[model samples]
Target chain A: MIQKILNEFSVNFHFYMKLLAEHIGIIAVSISIAVVVGLWIGILISKKPKLANYIISVVNIVYTIPSIALLGFLISLTGIGNTTAIIALTIYGLLPIVRSTYVGITTIDPSIIEASQAMGSKELQILYKIKLPLAFPVIFSSIRNMVIMTVALAGIASFVGAGGLGVAIYRGITTNNEMLILVGSIIIALLALVLDGILGIFEKLVLSHKLKKIGYKRFTAVIVAVIVGLTTILVTQKSSKDTIEIASKPTSESYILAEIAGELIMNETDLDVNITHGIGGGTANIHPAIEKGEFDIYPEYTGTSWQIVLKKDENYTNDKFETLNKAYEESYGLTWRGLLGFNNTYSLGIRKELADQYNIETFSDLAQFANQFTFGAEYDFFEREDGYKALMDAYKLNFKKVRDMDNGLKYQALFDGKLDVMTVFTTDGQLSDSRIKILRDDKEFYPKYIAGFVIRKDIIKKYPELEEVFKKLENSISEMDMAEMNYRVEIGKESPRDVAISFLKDKGLWRDKDE
Target chain B: MNKIIEYDSITKSYNGKVILEDFSLDIMEGDFLCIVGTSGSGKTTLMKMINGLIVPEKGNIFIGGRNIKDENLISLRRKIGYAIQGNSLFPHMTVFENISYVPKLEGKKEEELSEIVNETMKLVGLPDDIKEKYPSQLSGGQQQRVGIARAYANNPKILLMDEPFGAVDSITRFHLQEDLRSIHEKTKCTIIFITHDIYEAFKMGIHILVMNNGKIEQYGRKEEVFKYPKTDFVKNLIAMAKLS
Candidate 1:
């Protein structure tokens, strides 16, 4: 089972590593931030009895909130994916750090404090030179505990589409792939254990000034530097490709570019567009990448470009596409090419047989049967401005139940007939392949998402021909073509680039002679 | 010599019980005043008030003519060296370090402190070989000597000792009392000594205040307090010393 899991991870090593980096990064950042903040707060509170009591009570209360629920609550505000997870884990790791700091600082001998005071040391000087040094052992150990909790909670965060070993583990569990599950579990456990051991040595160093005499600290530093250097070299060496990297979220347009547009751009333009997939909270993960010139191009939706990207919320009809295009052009220092052939709205998806049998052709018709169906959805779909919850409230549909499923599993569950219905991305290629029929929102419950490749504002100035490349892709791949392309890559187990190339050739956008 | 300390109408209580009421005293600059009181008679509490370690409920303690308050506490405490039984010589610090602690606090450099520590330890008859040893490894008598060494390190104007010889053997206690007399002659530090043993008090104390309950039953020169025995409390205390 372990071998099989290892093999599975080895096969999708890129996906797992990216996920590991993000989850572990958030946890690392959060814990460090928490330690610095918590230690100071703990020390401050130790000095002030009344303030300490109230801060401790607040931390205790926050700690009592379940990790998963807190992540969900955070996701409601920050949207789905790793950023939300980082936020939740940061908050959860505070209590141990705060409490330990408080206990440690307060427990120092009163005589020591008196002696310091008698020596003409001010409160601040005594705290740093004496109190903190005395409290170092306790504080660092609490941070060790926080690190462990951080790794564990970082895994939980991955359930909200926050990539980490958690995503791999959850994916393996849902698919009943024991090998994948073990791969994620073992790696995560190993990471935590190794980090814990490192912190153990750190705690010893802090407590025992004698360790400085032994040269053990210098030895540890050398070992850490070597390990980090070797890991970075190993990861970079493994991803050998004639690669053109494009950073993107795994949304509808993202899949289209990865499964369709990437190959087209590469084929006609003589570039190898390596689609480095990521999860998105709209332009948060992509726009900055474009501005920093980290990515060459990505398929960003028009509605997001309008409301989420351009920072405008004025309501308009489908004709607002021109307004969005003009706004992107005027404000964002980027070109907005014309749309992809379809409108990817928030589709109410159900099992095809159920939809056909019940004659539920539209969201209004489906509302009458809502009490009998449980809807599964991504965390953001329940909270986004144009999310399913807002749509549900607008249409007054009282569903029997609502379940939040991770992005990777929501569609799989729907296909398995485990979920009665789901709020799905309109451009998601899964809707076509899984044979799940989507109920039309006859009341126009969501805005139109016209897919287009968004590049850095300066890319146009760098390469004027990029505009021609986007125009060639405009209205070329329809909804059905995008779905077939996703099936070929995701389900057929073909490389996403291969799938994209084959589709482009079949569409005659690129000929065999072009390569 | 001027008076180094004065306790005026100093009253004390613990948990609604009066332990010391209207207690008063004056210690001339170099006087070694031993306050002899039985256990629970508020001798320790009175000594603590004199050092500003404890505050009196209804009266003031003037140390170098300044009332014990936040404004004068640090300087007042630095000038008064205090030691309790078990020697409370910081367990983690070596004897040398313990002796040099107060001098260092008074901003004395290492050269000056080292000289003072060695001289103080020698004056108390602590051997040079045990200078680096911690208090825990030392004998009961040695610990008490180190305690005295530390008290005199800073050249304080006054020293308060609470039952300093109580923890040592009788022979050691007698020798320590004699050492205290010679050390006091050399340093001229005003010592307010608290002891339950009336005989030791009479021998060590030039002036004795025989205390019972919360008030002084007799106060006069050591010979006079012992000879007069005015109140029944003082007489009983005198009788108890003879029986012990």
Candidate 2:
């Protein structure tokens, strides 16, 4: 297992380095801003103690908010990407810094203050010359905590389509690839520990009497260097404007489709392509991001675009593709292209043994034995308009128990026999397991989720050749092809880009000869 | 000797209770005056008024023949050295930095500040090598000397000490007292020392002011006050000193 992980690390070394740099950039910028703002507020409250409790209470309340929920809330206002991630991380980084500074300043020996005052030291002089130096050890420890916490929390940045090691972890979980998850987690922990050790050395240098003067100069130099490095990273990132940004939902299939689209665009067009994998809420986040031009294209499902994005009340089938495309182009300036020749629609899945024992091959057949078996699905399945409730009402089926499990854990639940039946997408990589039987939607109760690319109108206008590249992908991938590709990445531990390129090459869609 | 500090009819109260009522006193130039009092007798408060650290509701304090209300308080404090109990030395600063703090605030040049620190340290019987050490690295007696050096560094004309040696052992206290006496003789600065120990007052003071309940029980030369006690409080304090 260790050797496999080491191999994975070596294979994806450049990918990890890029994400690591982005992670450092996010932490550097956010922590620098937090320190300045937190110190100012801390000093302000220390001077006016009447305001201390109220300000600290406000910071404490913000700190109590779960980071993921905070990131989700920030997405509406800031849009998605590093801006939203930085803002959320900065808010999380504030409480410790503010509280520590306030406590450190206020708790200094009163006699020391009195002595300075009596020696003709002015208020500002005493604060700078005496109080801050005395309070530094306390404040530095909290900053150390903030830095370590920020390093770990930065993993969540990938959720909102921001770049970080979290992309690896999120992808790992979505694909049920344990190696990627373990590697991402271990790297994040190591990053935190390394930063903490560095800070410990810095603290010692700054606090030691003989080394104080030189240590301060070195500390300032380190801070300046970090700021410069982060600025360069941010500037260089923004300089690449002739680039296409493709996004994917947190699923192996979405990643594969995005990689395919990215490979095609890069090969055929005179433009660079950046793909952000495993966006947190799928279409819910990616739709707004595309409209804001933060992302240029993403793989979205027809039923999801119609119901979730367009807020249509009815189930969308193959016949409504034109209306869905028209609504997207007219209202959101987004156009759907490249029907990937698959219906990854919702289906009931059961263990093959259970299916045979019950003689159930369709929704209607399962309805008879529903009361005897436990049903499980991802959390959103119960909440979506065309989800669990609609399906149950359509078939008049009521199970003995229903479990709301994570999308990643549902397959394991079914395999363990803890779940007798569960919701599954037709092209889900886990569905390729022979032990699980995909039940027929004989009643056609679920909406048709034909997979395709949704691109911004402006991107299509800029790179007209992209439309031709996407057209070749139209009706090209069969359901088996997509499931097989997903299985390769999810179970076979193949890179999505490699899987995507191979799939496109096999179909003669890859323009490697022209490139 | 000229009167360097005079308080006229000072009235001060806290929480509707009078701490000092109609307090009046004169501190002469170059006098090593010790004020011996029990707690709440307002000895520290009275001494603080000279440097404008305390304000009396119904009194005028004249320092160096000028009404302190007319003087900038920072400038006034710069002219009057003040030290308190427990020798509140700033723990983060080196001994040299602590000693030269006031002079630095006065905008002395780096060389001048160092010279002043060296001179003050020598005056306080501190060795030259301890200058770079922080307060936390020093012994209790050493910290107290640094505090005294800091108070005297700028060479103020008046020094107010409120039990500056209160936290040190008796041996250290005796040595500190003798050193302070010599420092006073060398500088000839007016020093107002407050102490709960009457013997400390008798041994070190040129003049003694016995205070009880914020009123002056007796005020005169130490020998005169000891020989001719006019109040019961004065007699009791003198008797305590004799017993000790």
Candidate 3:
């Protein structure tokens, strides 16, 4: 285990360091915002006892809320992204800061107050000089605890689409990769340890001094350092455009496809790939990641790349491959590496008996009794215009209820009759194995298309060889062949690289062991 | 010739128990007036009322003919030197800072303030070098003297003390009383002191108020209160205290 950990450290040392630096920068900004806002509130509370009571009560209530629920609540409002993550973490970090500030300032001995007042000092002067100074130890400890919590909460922020070490852990969980999860968790723990060590040194220096000499100079210095340090971290952080990251959606099928394509290109070509999974399927996040230079390449579905990204209705199909090919290139400044010969089309799927019993031969057939049936769909499909939701509106079908299910669980829901019909990808290997029947779109409202590799327009110009590799894969595999490749990786527990090589050898695209 | 302090018809209560009803007193300038009473006799409450720390629920307190009310309460508090049984020094501040506190609060120049602090420290018999230390480092008696120096620093016209010498050793208490007398003579401040020790009151007070329940049974010169014995409560207190 140690050797494995050491090997990971040696290989991805820079990656983890960069990830650490990013987490620190983000967390520092979050904690600073929390502290400033909390302390201001704390000071206000100190002045108005009743306001303090209300704010403290609210913060205490917020602290009791489950972290994931809070993240989910924010995601609904802000959309899944880093802003929601930071805001949620910052809110969680507020309770200790505000409570400590209140406790510390209010608990100073009343006699000291009498002394200050008898000295002709004003109320404000006494608070700043006597009350706050005496309360320093307690307040500082609360801030220290807050810093630790900010680090932990910031890691969880990655769940709501914030990128940090937590991304590695979440991806690790979905893919069942223990090593990746361990590394991510260790980095977070170390970040907390390092922060505590720094603060511990600070606490020692502060408390070691003659408590009397802890006047405005020392107090102001600490505040100044915190402000300057936070600003420096934020100002000097790497922008999205400066580095390359590659993320894929759906932990199983699409991710494997993107990984194989990325590995082939990154090995045969010169670009790098980060290969993250589960960021809402298709070209939406990938397109932006590439445009922002966070990712260099990802596999995107044709209908999604066309209908949604290109903003064209299904009518403009001069050719399924040719129209999408031409449109994406011009519109997104991306090159559609010719089709990989797999159409992961959105099909109206149901259990074989349900499909036969209802005599649902076409999507229009379902519209007659659509209000009586419940549909189960992957969360994103409920919203996307090119997704099952849009097709329902295009064909004027209304379902009794549309429940969101995880990608892996939707098929199970169909088999169990929990869903009357679900939107499933046509090319999912489980469709044939699970005995699910697909209904035809007689109105041609649904688009038939292949999923394939997409790279930035600049990457194609930079590495001309990428076009040849994508072309080779396109010619080498058909829809059934691609489905079989996905089945081996997804269910057969075979690595994508092994699956790719086996497929390449069977098709005579790759040389055998002798070569 | 000396009339720096007086409390007229002072009445206070807590939880419906009359503690100091219809209490009246007077202290001349430079007079060390100690009102001796047992615990809960309202002596501490009366002194606090005189300094506007606690207000009488009934009756008015005139400090320099300005009735002690909201308008001049804080200003009156600043001018009345105050100390309590708790050697309640600001823990974060040094001995010197706690001593010079009042002078600084009055916006005295730092250089002159330091000099005045040094002079007061010497008068209170606190070592000049102890100014650099914090209250936590000092002994109980030393903390109280720093309290005294802080109270005396403002040079207020009236000093209100509630069992100020109660926390120290008898030797330290005697020394503190002597220091108090010398400081009062030099500053000409009227002192309204509270104590349970009748002997200490007789030893130090120009006038003594023997209080029982809520009202004063006798208020007269120390010699008169000692010799005349106006009330049974006063006689019993003197006999119980073994006051000669």
Please give each candidate's TM-score: 0.66, 0.92, 0.70
What tens digits encode model 3's per-residue C-alpha lDDT throughout A1-515? 97887776677788777667667767877788888887777777977788888989999999999998898677556655556777898898888889888888788777777766665667788877788778889988998989988887777776666667786676566555566678889889998999999888778876766432566477768867976785576555534342334457645566566666755655555455555555643355456656655556777777677666777765433276676777767876777775677666667776787667778788888888788888888888867867765787778999898899998888778777898888876777666554677777777666766677777888778767877778877745565566666666556645555676566657655533332
iRMSD in angstroms, per model: 4.3, 1.0, 2.0
User: Who is ahead in TM-score, 1 or 2?
Assistant: 2
Q: Please write out the lDDT profile of model 3 over residues B1-244, one tens digit for every residue.
A: 6455567887788898888777676667667788888788887787777766677877877666666674555567678788878768787677777777777766779898888898888878888778878777989889889888888877788888888888899898888888888887788788888888888888788889888777778988988988889988889877866744
lDDT of 1 by residue, A187-300 (tens): 889889999998897677645445545666686688567555544543463265544455556442365474465666665665566554543343765675565554557777
In order of DockQ, best first, we have 2, 3, 1
Whole-model lDDT values for every prediction = 0.73, 0.89, 0.74
- Better TM-score candidate (1, 3): 3
Better of 2 and 3 by lDDT: 2
Ranking by TM-score: 2, 3, 1
Looking at model 2 chain A, which ten-residue stretch has the lowest summed lDDT?
A209-218
TM-score of 3: 0.70
DockQ values for all predictions? 0.13, 0.70, 0.38
